[model samples]
Target: MSIAKRLASQTAIYGVSSIVGRVLNTLLVPVYTARFAAAEYGIVTGLYAYVAFLNVVFTYGMETTYFRFANRPDTDRRELYSRVMTLLLLSSALLTTVLALLARPLMSLLSLPPGHERYALWIALILGLDAVAAIPFARLRLENKARKFAAIRLANILLNVGLNLFFIVFCPDVLAGKYLAGLRPLVEGLYDPTIGVGYVFISNLAASAFTLLLLGRELLDFRPQLTLAPLRPLLQYAYPIMLMGLAGMVNETLDRILLPRWLPEGFYPGKSNLAAVGIYGACYKISILMSLVIQAFKYAAEPFFFGQSNDKNSPRTFALVLKWFTLCCAMLFVGVSVNVELVARVFLQRPEYLEGLAVVPVLLLANLFLGVYWNLSVWFKLTDKTYYGTYIGFAGAVLTVALNFLLIPLLGYMGSALATLACYFLMAALCWWLGERHFPVPYPVARLLAWLALAVGVVALSWWLPVAEGWPRYGLQALLTLGFVGLVGVVEGRRLRTI
Candidate 1:
């Protein structure tokens, strides 16, 4: 098959799962902010932010390690799969056990409110399952079993959404009255209704555990081995990526972690700043469409590009792939930005939460640069110059932390958005600059800039146009979105057809 056809097939499997997964997850925004109070949803938001950071720590870059080693000429691919899977399984079991034992102190350490300790417990298990699940999923990717990979992902996510609806919507009131009338004694003893976000974690925990049942084939593929001969290079490659992944995650998620503490004091008793955090976070979901594309692209592109590293036409393919990736991502940015007011409403679910509409565009463009940087990063990955990636990612991480420290106190939630955008922009530039010397690809510099510039012009005019209350605003956004589509068709329509 042609490379384009291969990519198309892989992308379809990966993209459908991602789109479905995120869209399912987005339903939680309504479940959270509308059904539950915004302050309560903020706690949910903040906790998940920590989950994202911790997940990177637990997996510790093993996915990339699996890909790197499994493809090497001298390696026993089945043994490689078993080794990585065993490592993750052991680590996940140990981590979950440790957290469970220390749940009491850990809850107090994070300053959980009265009667919220179980919240810590449930999320820890969810993270554990997710960490272990990473191994089999990576194996699937290694085997090019994206269809099975997508199936597991979609199934797990859909189940979680289904259960969340049951608990938060259908069962809450009924169970609250019938079982809860008896349970309120226990509730008063150890639970809080406002902390209903715990049920969200509980639903995820069930789904995560259920996902494990489908990993049987991957686990039975080969016997586990721990000889130093094969393990050393994989760890060497993985350890640096762990640093890079950590730094990258901090850049992506530190804001969500910091916002609750960093906001100005004095308002509602339990949480005033939390509502603001939830509002910012809900708007963040609107940008999840960009995140979804990046995720699926990463899944398809990483192993694909890595396996192509030794191909004679690898650089040429990489260059072409990077160009197309940028154009598609930038068009997505334009699509979301042009119609953001409409998109924001779906996630926000409340009139007052509209304050976060401004950050949507900023976050969208930042993700565009992030996706571009990922494409450009094939240089470092293919050339075995990952130390440069470490440096770039670390620099971005530091920039993220420093910006949040300096600005969050001053500018509130908007500061977090700025920090993220700045960090990603710096990291992308550093990767490109360092990449050029080690392994240059003839990137379509002019075309990329042109697409970006066109997006800016269209978005600016769209924003400037009168978009008052009611359907007119939605109509204007729709028109702007269509204009972006029309422009894309003009520029790349012919090329797209040929591909």
Candidate 2:
């Protein structure tokens, strides 16, 4: 089979898990926003932002490191897996214990409410289970078990969503005497209305635990050997990658963490810190369409790239993938940006949470740049210059912090969104320039930029159009989206026919 076909197939399978899972996850946004006040939902958003950072810390780049060494000619795949698994298991256990013990202090440091220290415990357990399961999930990707990967992933999502519904919806009905009287006591015991967003965390923890159960075979398959021979090389490779992951998370999520705290004390006198956070967080999900696409591509691309590293035409292949990725991401950006109000209403569904709708376009464009940056990032990974990734990520993180700190106070979450856009645009440009100097991939920069330009132009035209909100506006946007697609097909069609 062709490399492109393989990657496409892998992407499709991964997309089933990522796209479906995230779409379902996104659906919960309305549920969350509807049930909790902006401030309450903000707590959920802030905690999860910390969760993203902690997840990176727990896994410590082992998944990528596993891919790096597993492809080496001299490495024993089984031993490497065992060593990596051993290292993660020990560290995850120790980290979980330490964090659980320090849960109260950590909660205080994070400026969470007075009595919610257990949030720390739940987050710690969730991250620990997920970290330990990381290698197993990556193993599925490495072995080309995409269907199994999707199945396990979807199962986890289904379980989590199911539990969330039961706790948040069904149990409440029962407790309120809207259902089974006999089960009222049990439902009352399980469902605490005051817990609010805590139910979301508990649901997630349950799902993570369930995923570990599903991955039992992968977990048990690895030997308990922890020798220094393989350990040294893996850690050496992973350390910088971990730093990169840390910085990347900072770039990705630190804004959500910082926004509430960074906003002026009386910025929203009527609202709590979480209220602004909740608003920014909800609007941020508006860009998940692009984010999920990038995530699915990354899931499939990482293993595919490593597997094809030794191929003679790998550079050309990477170039083609990058071009196509940019094209798709550009289309997504225009699609979401043009249909922003409809998308916002569908996902968020609450007027209050929609205050940050203006950030959607900025963030959509930011994620587009981010997707391109991910494509460019493969260069450093391929060249074993992983430290370059560390440098770029840290630089982006610095920009993120500085810009967000400056902007949030001035413009609220809009400033945060702009900061994100600036960080990613700079990162993508820097990576492209550096990639040319080190591992030239002949990225179709002009063609890619042309597509992006056209996408942005169409979106701009749609926005500036005087069509009133309703079917007329949607119809106009749809026509513009279709026009862009047709234009791409016409341009790329001629080139493909010649090939």
Candidate 3:
């Protein structure tokens, strides 16, 4: 198969679980926004921000390392995977045990009250299991089992979503032996009435364990040959990558963690901190559709790029991929941002969070820049100059933190929006500059600017069109999305048609 076809297949595989799964997950946003107040939802937001941070730390860049080493000619693929999985299992088990022992103190350190300590425990276990499962999943990708990769992903997400709906929508009244059939007697016997929040974690835990069960074949492939001598270089390579993950996560999640600390006092009298986080977070989910698309592209790109690093046409091909990715994401940005009111209404199901509508465009655009930055990031990763990623990520993290501190107090969550944009843009420029020094890819600078120009024009026209609410706005935006594709087809269609 052609690399492009392989890329498309892998992307679709990743996308099925990511984009489709997330689209299903989006169902919960409406439920959550409607069921919980912005303040209540803010707690969820803050908790999950910590989840994102913890996730990056637990995995510690091992997935990418797996892809790198597993592709090498001399590496014994199964043994390498077995060793990696062993290392992850031992480390994650030790960490999980230690964290469970110290859960209460860690909760307190994270500023959670005693009552929320169990939340810490549940998520820690979830993250640990996820960390251990990472290598098998990467093996699936390496073997080109895109269907299985996507299937497992979709199954996990579906389980989580289905359980959430059952708990939140059905557990309260219907399962009290009231009306719902097949209702587990367990719900009535030992369950607290108000443990809807806890059920979220329980569902995730169940699904995570199930995911591990599905990896039985991969797990059985583990050999006892996993020893310390062979792992030293991998760990050395991974340490900086882990730090880069940490820094990148901060840029992505700091706003959720810091809004409570940095919001101006009396911002909304009694309902300030969590409310701000909740609103920002709800609107944030609306923007995540773009991020999911970027992630799908990354999954397809990482292995492909790493393998193709030595090819003569690799630079030009990489440049075109970046161009295409940017144009496609730009279309998404304009489509979603221009008619956001419709999306906001359907996504949130709560009128109260409309305040965050203004931040959505900025967040989406920020995500587009971040996606572009990611494509550029491969230069350093391929050349083993990955220290550059760590440096850029560290700088971006500082920018994220400083901006949150400076602007959240003044402009509220919107400050975080601006800060995120600034940080991503800065990193994109910095990475491009540095990567050019080490490995120059001939990215179409002028044509790429034209694509952005086209997106700006499309958004301007949409804004001026005055579609007048409801279906009209969405209808016009849909047309604009299609029209942008048609326009792209006209400009670059023939070039892309070859393969």
| Best candidate according to TM-score | 2
Estimate, for each residue in 1-499, the C-alpha lDDT of model 2 and write its tens digit: 7778889899999999999888898888888877778888888888889888888899998999999999989988988889889999999999999989988887776577678988999999999999999999999999999999999999999988888888888888787788788998787777788887788999999999999999999999988977777588778888899999889889889999888779987786677777889988888887878899999999999999888889999899899898888887887888788888788778786788877888888889999999999889888998899999989998999999999989989998889999999999888998999999998898989878877877878888888999787898899888988888887778887865543
**Backbone clash count, each prediction separately:** 0, 0, 0
Error of 1 at 340 (Å): 1.6
lDDT of 3 by residue, 400-482 (tens): 99998999888888999999999998889899999888999898877887888788788778767865766877788889878
Which regions of candidate 1 fall more than 4 Å away from where they truly are? 102-110, 175-195, 266-271
- Indicate whether candidate 2 or candidate 3 has the larger TM-score: 2
**Model 1 vs. true fold: TM:** 0.92
Output the better candidate (1/3) by lDDT. Answer: 3
Per-residue lDDT for 1-499 in model 1, tens only? Answer: 9997898689878987787786788767866767866777777777788778778878988888788777779988777787887777778888877777777776664456667778778977988888988878887887788989999899889999998887676565554675546654554554435657787888899999889888767656767666767667877888888888888888888888777777667532354787877778888877778888888888888899988888888877888788788878877888788877767667777765677788888888878888888888788776666777789999999998899888888877788888999998898888878877888777777777888888878888877887576688778778777878787888788987887
What lDDT, from 0 to 1, does candidate 2 have? 0.88
Model 2 spans with C-alpha error above 4 angstroms: 179-182, 496-499
Q: What's the lDDT for all of these models? A: 0.80, 0.88, 0.83
- The Cα error of candidate 3 at residue 364, in Å, is 1.0
Candidate 1: residue 319 Cα off by (Å): 1.9
Superposed by TM-score, candidate 3 places the C-alpha of residue 161 at a distance from the truth, in angstroms, of 0.7
Superposed on all Cα atoms, model 3 deviates from the true structure by an RMSD in Å of: 2.2
> Least lDDT summed over 10 consecutive residues: which range in candidate 2?
490-499
